[model samples]
Target: MATSDLHMQLIAYDYVNDRKTDGGSLAKMASLIRQAREEAAETGALCILLDNGDTFQGTPVSDFLAKHPGTHPHPMVDALNALRYDAVGLGNHDLDYGLDYLGRCLAQFQAPVLCANLKTSALPMIMPHTIFQREVQTASGETISLRLGVVSAMPQLTASWNRHQLAGNADVEPAMPSLVRAVQEVRNQGADVVVALAHMGIATIDEGEDAQNEIVAIAGIPGIDAVVGGHTHLRFPGPDHNGVQGVDSETGLIGRVPTVMPGNSGSDLGVIDLRLHRPENALHPQVVSCTVQLRSVDGETPEDTEIAAVSEMAHDKTRAYLARPVAQLSNPMHSYFALARPSHVPALLAAAKRKAISEAIAGTELERLPLLAAVATPATGGFDGPENFVSLPAGELKRRHVAGLLPYANQVWAVKATGARLSGWLERSALLFNVLRPGDGDQMLVDPQVPGFRYDAIYGLTYEIDPTRAPRFDAAGKAISNEVGRVSDIRWQGKLVDPDQEFLVAVTNHRAGGGGVFRPFDDAEIVVKKAAPLDQALIDYLKNPDCHDIRTAAPWRFTPKLGVSAILHTAPEALEHLGDIPSLHPEPYGTTPEGFARLRLHL
Candidate 1:
């Protein structure tokens, strides 16, 4: 029988120890790597470790590194070097610190970093593709030579933030073509297996889907064996949407073509093993089997000592830096996740945006306009998670913490839409919830099953969603409902809104561009000019005292039929502000005293 050779053990997406507790995942990952390495050695197999991306910024450590640069070197890079990652891809979050910081972080890593889509003529070290060739001795003692080619592609949305640094030098335009060409070039150089390490997410037919996401779009191009993807942070055991299956290493389930994504923040390790069989022509070897394995970073094993030590050092350094009080706030600031409840953080943010938009347009042809402002809770905004919680010890609130609370640098934009258009936008937001049927369901106020997208809106006008009622509008802005849910108690000039009256509305650029799938405002008439450094408006608004009133209730209210049981779910912090509302509920079914009395009082 021909001697069988195993080319195996590929580890993917170990985001190790972010800014949180000294890299919770990093310490675990180090131990996992050590174990994997030992296992690979015992099995006479080669181990290649690849990190997909988002290593640079997530926790407080990343925050400190970005703000107070000289105090601490890039700790994430240091941890990755300790883990001895073979190659790393540049994710969009890595660029959050700006290009110069990204370069510094890259320099700190010993491993070769590849970002095929992100280019800089000035920096030759930032190569688009890397080719690694290894000569391995089989169990039968025959040496087999193999070449692996890796090319990386990041999402195009990063263009907005990376423009300054990546401009003129970084070419995101021809990314897929460049990736294809890079794979071809590597094949020409005799690479046996070509892998496209993509930093983009799984493609969807929705608005955010990038053209490069279609695996078939790049598949069938010459010499591509496997594609490693990231950015979306989804775990695909099989080749998702592309017939790829992750090789099961433990079960020896071979021949699976799975595109693997180890869950974000070093939660899991993706392992792919390839078995090589040499044919008559040594150059053209056959890939007999492919296997995938996933090792949890949170396993009970002891942490990797070296990585643990480095994470500890980073933790101590970050704690000390953030420990120094930065600023003091007269009122306590809190963050709560539940959307039904009122939160000081989102309320503060919304109030700030409202004031800024109001000031920006106060006397400029859009004065005294009723505007709705909204801000998303960055951490809990993802539709999952227990109530959003922000712990504020009674004292000075650091600017760093505040910045951490609102991390995304999204700008504020004002657009003018009609009452119908605005109602459609809220309806889209309501779609974030699961459609609940009346009489068969629990309280409507705190339906946890209701998706976060629906509860996320902080409105200038009060509104209620009738779960039983189908949407009145289609994805396009056309009326589909006759008399479903009402946007009642909407007082403009001390009275209900007239459908014919035009209202000036304000929202973030993310919202304006239909980020939350609210497409109605995309066609809204834009009034105020776009503000540069939009987050600056937020910062300025926060510093001003006149803008801090968050006690005002939303003008409208939902009056479901008697005994219909309306429930609202919001973060714990929101309870402080929303506690008095008759309609407010904690979550699921917990309702306030006011809610009970309101039903009785109104009935």
Candidate 2:
């Protein structure tokens, strides 16, 4: 059994929203773990529970702990130790809080923390591979000892993504070669079966050795038996990945290996069952067949008392800090119609980031150039469902509201970019919308495959997104040849932008560090790196009255197309704020069975 991308949700409660969410939390997933173990025991099988990384960060509880490092014994570690995980792998997000904090977490976890790709002489809490010997009874009533060799690797961009925390702390190696060597070492050590805990998503195309998401390629390695994959928050053996060329989506098989990528945030548990047999002439057990499936967690599932108990103290502490007021909201903010047009969520972020970049590059040659800010909404409705939209009422805003705005700990970065690069950046972002015809009706506005966080809009520029034109980039951010771009009529400071002119754009380090594999930063140099993350900057931005100019800014709009209409899905509560986006000409189109409110917008 495997769980990936838990994101430090040790409790079945949301401190940010102050409600008990059903499908997330370690306490909730702990129930599924127990049931899986019981089911395996009934068949006289040895069940080992493992977790892929992204385990140490995400929730308000983890944020509270990050502010005060030694306040508690690492809430995630307490829950993992209580559940008795066999082995844990590292994800890129697991190292966000800094190396010292990760070292403390590594010491607190009772299980072996495995990372074959990351190398560091400073911290010795990681191992390339580990072996677990367990005794299980076969169908023939024979008891035998099995050696389970576990190897783990994450994306090579780990250091880059968390650039401030990891440059001197560790060196993140490439996943493909690292895992291949680690698997060979495990085989040379006489392990019976090898399992790969890959902290990566499956790539549809065969990207070479250095690509970030390469589980499909990793599964083709020589000695691997079963693979657990993550980092894209996608599920395998399900409809989310239906028609990829090299994968058997229904069976979760890449080539002959059964690969499982459990959905993020404790949504599903990945179970890969292997039936093994030993021939009369063989000295060790051999796998006869393999199958993979996902078990989902719902509201009715019971929470494990032990795991719940392990998380309560820290939960209380986080809730106390969550109530502390950060600022007074001059206006309300909601992501309901962020995709339909510009919303206050991104606008507010742009204001904060732009001000920070201006101060950071003051008096420098970079400051003399045109200044702009590019930001994406984190709370757009995607795999997180309709409730994913940010909804902050006007009043005394608290830290919880800030958390709702931008949850990740992304630091600010100022990069030098040219007009050509900026245009490519906007075009890449325009890939979020599908091509719409002049007379097509009720078409989906955004692609389900494209995440909202990748759809960035530059705050200081005005452009038209031509959904009718082909995109210069694909879904994976790779360039497509001979295609007219989706973004056109690019203007900055009320003037047409020259392709050769320079500009300083403010963005989070995640983008500068290859979060979406953006090409603008391929050879770009960041002039400023903020020590304090944008979360802190946002708090300061909200308290000041000078930053209120972003309240009514609209960055980008669709190219005019008569008699065309499209459907945009948002939260049901979005109807209350329909007045905010008068330009979209939104009309109520009822609700989806999945609870998203559909708004028909004329293109």
Candidate 3:
């Protein structure tokens, strides 16, 4: 048997929420990491642990770190350091709490933070690329030295998506060229095998700079032996959650280069094994073949005792903070009808944001403009799973419940938009659905590629979505077709919305700052901007001891189409409410491949 010259194991994980429980707790992942290292040791293979960023924020625990910063190490940094991560990359969310805070928090990380595309002068801690020299025991019982190079890059859109946080501090340049340059630079440093830790998604279709979904293109770059991808919060070695064109849901390979994304919230760990081969007289080794796999921290796994013990104090504090009662839900709160119709969750959020905007613009010249609030549930089983839907019963609500409702700490902004621009916004949002053929069989209602969070539900305006008509705009908010128009009968205060009339649209800085492909939002005049997150306003509203029942009125629905029916993919738990929503006329229709149940809606 020919003895293998180099056996290397690479472990990559991303989107850890500093969760100490539920689906993904770094404490639970510690055991899996230890197990992988043990297996690699037994096989005499070198092991490297790399985090693909988005590690600092997600749950209330991480929220605590960002909201209340101190000299102490962030719980996430503590956990990662305890696990001894080799390196990590920066994700857009990592910059959510301002550049200074991000820098301070990352400074405590034992692992080197790398970001090649981020243009900055203040933070010297970030490296473009890094090289590691290691000694590996070959299968033939011979010890040989190996050189491994790792480079990291985040989406160029980080500049826009995190505009509130990165303003006047740093800018993220285009990722593709910058990443390619970093790869070449690392190779020039005498590195044998190269890896790209890409904090971007793998979308088959391109949507320009804001799309920033460049993992597929990154994988095709030469000298990049392997890739660890993030930002999309998707799971690899599984069916593509979104039907992104070029992605192979099963293998996660782009043109033969092996890549893996471990899914978000520390749910799973991405494992890539590379075999290095070199001629006996060669100066460096090259990758021969690579195998990729994802290990999920599912129900069967137990948390590492030592890690749990280390993080127990913080975990207890977070739980206590999250459990504080804020308000009472007179009835159950669910997002099953978030896109299909108005739900109380977003209805309450829009009401609070509308009030906040109203207060912010009370004396301004723009105060007279009619105000409308746009809200969307960030989670809809897209990446958070089927059970990710909100379903708090009639009882006291807590800080955690409110956090679950909105999730991200997105700031609220009131944008001055003309009715025409508002129409375009609604048209762009309608792209979330597929066109319903007049006489066709049951078809999927939503566009798999568009996330549920991107589907905006405008409050203070009533509209009907005509599925038989085609969408007027594409995902990038560009007008794609004239024959198909999904948005129709748009009305304000029981009257038609004038195309030229101006209005104040209550939106998040994420949308107003051009986080999505929504147009006009980038250039729209900002009449009101809140320094605090939208969730804060909600928490205050809920905390009011005199808070009443959350009022949810159905102001929008699908236009009646006699012969067409649609399939709504939702949490299986929503089946119990089939008879409650009269507008949708929903009926259970078995389960989808993603474990979500399908509901047949009679239009």
Top candidate on TM-score is 2
What is the overall TM-score of model 3 with all chains considered together? 0.91
Task: Evaluate residue 374 in candidate 3 and report its C-alpha lDDT on the 0 to 100 scale.
Answer: 87
Candidate 2 per-residue C-alpha lDDT over 1-603 given as tens digits, one digit per residue, 9 for 90 to 100: 999999887877766788887666778889989889899989888888889899988888878888877756876898888888999999998888888878988988789999998999756989999998899898989888888899999998786787777777689888888999999998888788899999999875444434788888899999899999999888998887788878999888999999999988888899999999889988667888998999888888888889888888888888889999989876777888888788878988998898888877777777688888999987888888877888888889989888877788889888888898899899888989988776777789898778899889999999988887788887766778998788988998789999999998899989888677565364347777872489988887777845357776887888765457888999999888787777678899998878899998887
Residue 11, candidate 2: how far off, in angstroms?
1.9
In candidate 3, what are the lDDT values of residues 240-311, reduced to their tens digit? 534665566666677778788777665677898988888789877877777888887765677777666655
Judge candidate 2 at residue 429 and give its lDDT: 89
Regions of candidate 3 where Cα sits further than 4 Å from its true position: 1-22, 241-252, 438-441, 543-552, 592-595
Residue 170 of model 2, lDDT score: 84
Query: What is the total number of backbone clashes in candidate 1?
Result: 39
Of the candidates numbered 2 and 3, which has the greater TM-score value?
2
Query: Which residue pairs in model 3 clash with each other?
Result: 470-484
**Across residues 39-123, which tens digit of lDDT does each residue of candidate 1 receive?**
8888878777787777776655566556677745455666677767777777766765567777766777787888877766644
